[model samples]
Target: MTLTTALALGQTALKLGLICSLTVLALFLSYSMLNVCDLSTDGCFTLGAAVGAAVAICGHPFLSIFAAMLAGACSGFVTAFLQTKLGVESLLAGIIVNTGLYSINIAVMGGSSLLNMNKTTTVFSMMKEALSSTPFAAQTELIIGLIAVICVVAFLVFFLKTRLGLAIRATGNNADMVKSSSINPVFTTIVGLCIANSFTALSGCLLAQSQKSVDINIGQGMVTIALASLLIGGTVMGRGGILKRAVGMVLGAVIFRLVYTIALRFNMPAFMLKLVSSIIVVLAISGPYLKSQWPQIRRRLTHKKGGI
Candidate 1:
């Protein structure tokens, strides 16, 4: 390729990278807060979009976005309650809630499988009008997504330092320990799930507004995607402070998106997207475990050399 073409492609890749990273960061925060691999993300995402679109269609675009967030929080709350109080398995609870959300999302859309917001005022539309009238609409979405990601990251960073946030983290790390300290682990779980689901819902709402529509299946397998992003970020960023991990998760999300985009560009079958995502996540989750064993292996090799 010519130099100019190469530069253009590079720029495109960078933009795509930014988009993916921000997305992953959002997922990482949600998952970290919930302390569960929330399957509800799949349905809650669609619910957010549907609610946001419906609200926008009714001339309350901003309120619709907020409503979408609230809806998502409720979904998380249900899952948390089921898992904590009803003693349901976290995964099964998430599935049940997800299943129920499918019908609820349809109901929100008045029984339609999809809702278009072509003429509806959306969050991005207002942002475009308020910020700039540029034709590069995707740029507007990027800015908004970035801002949202940054805000969440900052909030989470600060939150983990607070008493409540530490309690939640402690609950996730060791429920018995937290409970033994006279703190209610159940409440922590509920609050964490609520925060996580709220972020996921916000992502869904923004996505719908960005696309100007909502498809019922838009969030299908979203939990996997989010997990992939989190894993990728964690692997690449390495473990340290809470802030580092959170930032890494976001970076991982961007990396996952870039890999997917590249696969698509190579004419890879769409069906393989999820397969690739799964492989990436598996590798990422295994990285830390493998690293931990490296020192032992190195010591063994050193002893063998000395014996030789």
Candidate 2:
């Protein structure tokens, strides 16, 4: 590729990676910290896009962000309620919420599958206009995404160190123990999921605005993508401080997006992208275990060679 082409590709990947990193961060909170595999992520993401787009189309660009987050928190609350109060299984609760959100998303989009913001003012456009006189005008999306990531990371770092955050973490580690310690596991679960899903919604909201369009299927397979990114981050950072791991999540997202962008550059069919994601997920999930077993496998191979 020419230098210009490479630069464009890198920029595309970085923008997308940063936006999607929010979802990865959400997964880091819900899946890793809470030990809850939330299957509702895809729907919740779409919910955010739909809600954000709807609000923005009504002439409230900035309000759209908060609206999307609030919508996602409601979705999370429903899922958490099912699991904690209704005695539903966490996975099943997520599945139910995801299934329901499809209809709700459609309603939010005025029963349409797509919403176009071609002429609507979005946060990106607002930023672009604000920076038009500066050299950063063309980098509005990047700047916004970077700011969002930094804010979320900082919030996570500080929040995880607070008392409630410690209780949430303990609940994830052992609910029974947390209950014994006088912490309400139910409350912690609800709060944790609400916060995590809000982040997921923010990611989707920014993505929709950046792309200037919202599609019903825009968030399809997002859970897989976020999980893959989270696993990649865990592998990269191993066990470390919250800030370290949080940074790893961003790095993982960028790396994953870079690989994805390269695959597209190779002229891979659009249909094959899902397979690429699946392959990457498998590799990320299994990499640590396979690395740990390498020595044993090598020893067995040497013994077999000697016997032969």
Give the TM-score of each candidate. 0.86, 0.94
lDDT of each: 0.77, 0.93
**Predicted structure 2, TM vs. truth:** 0.94
On residues 215-307, what C-alpha lDDT tens digit does candidate 2 reach at each position?
999999999988887887788788989999999999889888888898889998767766777887898768878999998999999998994
Report residue 256 deviation for candidate 1 (angstroms).
0.9
For model 1, what is the error of residue 149's alpha carbon versus the real structure, in angstroms, after optimal superposition?
Answer: 0.9
Highest-TM-score candidate: 2
Q: Name the 10 consecutive residues with the lowest summed lDDT in model 2.
A: 268-277
Clash numbers, per candidate: 3, 0
For residues 1-308, what per-residue lDDT tens digits would candidate 1 score against the true structure? 57875555444544544444443554555466546777888898888878888888999977986898788889889999999999999889989999999999999999999888888877788888877656665467777777777887898899987999888878777767886897797898888888777777777878878778889998887778778878777768876998889888777777677677667667898789788878877777777788999988888999999942
CA deviation > 4 Å runs, candidate 1:
1-30, 133-138, 286-308
What TM-score does structure 1 among the candidates reach? 0.86
Clashing pairs in 2: none
